[model samples]
Target chain A: MTIYENKYRITYEAFSKFSAKLSKANDKAELLEIVQKHLKYFFNFKYFRVLLKDEVFLKSFHVFHNSNNSPEFILNEFFSYEEDLLKNHIPIQHSSNGEFLNNYDQKLNLNNGKLWAWYFKYQDLQLCVSLISDDEKPFIVRDIEILNLLIDSFVTKYQQIKLKNRLHQKNVNLKNAINVIEEQKFQISKIVYNQKNTIEQRTKKLKDQNSKLAEISRLNAHNVREPLSRILGLLEIAELYEEKDLKKEIFEKIKTSAKDLDHILQDIIYKSNNAIEKLSSKTPPTK
Target chain B: MMPDKIKIFLVDDQKIANFITQKLLQTSNIDCEVLAFDQPIQALDAVEKDLPNFIFLDLNMPKLNGWQFLEQMQKNITSKVIILTSSSDPADVEKAKDFPQVISYQTKPPSREILQELILG
Candidate 1:
């Protein structure tokens, strides 16, 4: 096989392997690790870094960097360049002696290197990948094409992971809503049960009062009538009698019967007043 | 035809009531042998020995009420009973209809006209 054909075959084989690994990634951290490994194998650079902003938590980020003998690149130092890159969706390149190198802290070894950085939107997230090389040869058009292909896979995997997380959050929210509704239903039923008990107790008390009133009525009919009847009988008999002595005896009986009737009336009044006082003194129960 | 010298029994718990009833009957000059009793049990015992032609019964009593006396008297006697009660309550009047031996129900102080009609009828 020709050298160019061999190179193409190797690139295709590596891309297939990287895609398999990315599909198996469960979350952002795992996907970032797989991306870093694949990028390092495809393009050997002095420095490599990836910065991914979370879709849900805007201020949070996942950063993956190649740590093989490369000088530490503090993410905070390059934050100034993010706004311009995010707006344009364009790549920024810097040669070894470019003025752009001056923007970073001098401690970083980016001073004698060629830097390439791209910022783009993937689904609901902002993704940025940077490559720095100290070699004399500048990046060719073919290198950019392979980098873009790898970045496309990274964006797809990230979208899948973010969609899954959002769906899980929606499920949790739905569960909480159902639980709240159930609790409210239980409270309402308990209130109804308590109200039923209150009604039953009140009905029983009323029934007792009704029976007492009925007894009072019975006493009025029987006991009260007994004395009144005797008075009436004596008066009728006095009308028929001719002798003053017999009439005087009938008057005496009439007086006794009248007093007995008066006593019955007073007893009825006393009992009724007591019932009224007892009812008035009672207080209703609180909720 | 009205029977001459009708044997009448008067039963009540109150002694004053019996005295007044006996005096009213005696003053009326009816041709009847009136036997008055303050206790219902004594009246019931007298009834078993010699059943009166007519009985005037009072409902409320301590030992035995008018209903119990009527129930006992009905077992052997065929005498007519007139319920004379102080209670003019409709329930008591209605209850008097249950006794087969009861001929009439009357409230206290039965008028001379009513007594004369009962004796003549």
Candidate 2:
């Protein structure tokens, strides 16, 4: 088999194993282990790290086949390069810098190269993916293309897996919401039981208050009208007199007092009408 | 029988506007006999007896709006019609373009200079 055919078979077999593990994997740790295993075997990188764009600290696991020395220096260099790439219009791959520009270098870095870096782009995230390998075989351009295709597939697969997890969580949340609603329904009767006595007490108190206020208002209106009627009647008689100057003065006084009383009565009537109108609009008119 | 002077007819509903326009025409260097009319129908009747050289008409009125008055007056008299009104509406502004007799549309109580210019220019 050609190198491509070999790599394809290896990647396919590993993905099959990972797909099986992905179904049963409960936590991130189990999922990560399966992921690391498949990624290491298939992509053949010295170091492999998955840095979530949302995370403050990058989360990655590395495996070096040839050397015991860790590729921590390579990651430090990559962090600045990644920031620059995002800020400027620079592409991912820089030959001098310890990173991969396109998808191919990522696989090359993992397999046999001493230094390699890659980034996976999504809607709201940029994953700084990298690998370090020390091998005689130079990274071929065709292999890089295949690697680019492979990572793209991986990103799609990753999204699908995450969506499935979200759906599962959503089902659990819906179940919890239903349970809470059922519990609330059971407790709702008790709330109604408690509110009934309080409502009755409040209603009785309000009625008593309303009656007392009405009685006071009636008494106040009676007291006001008696004096006002006497003044108004005298003014009306003075208005009918033959003397124009005297008649005008009394007429003006009576007009002012009469207007004040009319205003007060109209205001009370208007307020009552407004209240009734509001209540009627809210409640469907019963035929 | 009439004096040797150019007679100008002012047609507008606003008495003050007509008064001001009359004053401007009187003070203007252009020697003209100015007659003011608050009622457009009365003005139309007066114009038939002796048509003036210029007729300043207010665009908006109660009985007969300036446009209709101009149409009726145009049928009878050969006076140069000029629209004068406080209305800044585009429709009213565009009235001058449609009416061939209308020399210009002046925004209310036009300056004495502009009034003189309208009559002489």
Q: How many residue pairs clash in each candidate?
A: 0, 13
| Tens digit per residue, CA lDDT, model 1, A1-287 | 99857866888789989999999999876876676667655654655555656544433232223242322223434444555676686887876443444443433344467767788676567867776665543454467767888888877887888789989999999999899989999999999999999999989988987997897788677998898888878876776676877647777777878888899999989987987888777967566
lDDT of 1: 0.74
Question: Distance (Å) between predicted and true CA of A286, model 2?
Answer: 36
Candidate 1 CAPRI assessment class = medium
DockQ values of all predictions? 0.58, 0.00
TM-score of 2: 0.35
lDDT of 2 by residue, B17-101 (tens): 5655665677668788889999999998999997888899886688898878877866656788888765555656775687788
True contacts kept of 2: 0.00
Off by over 4 Å in 1: A1-26, A33-47, A54-90, A95-113, A122-124, A133-139, A149-153, A156-160, A243-246, A284-287, B1-4, B19-30, B71-74, B88-98, B111-121
RMSD list, candidates in order: 5.4, 27.5
lDDT of 2 by residue, A165-229 (tens): 88999999999999999999889978997799899998998799689767656645643453354
Q: Which number leads on lDDT?
A: 1
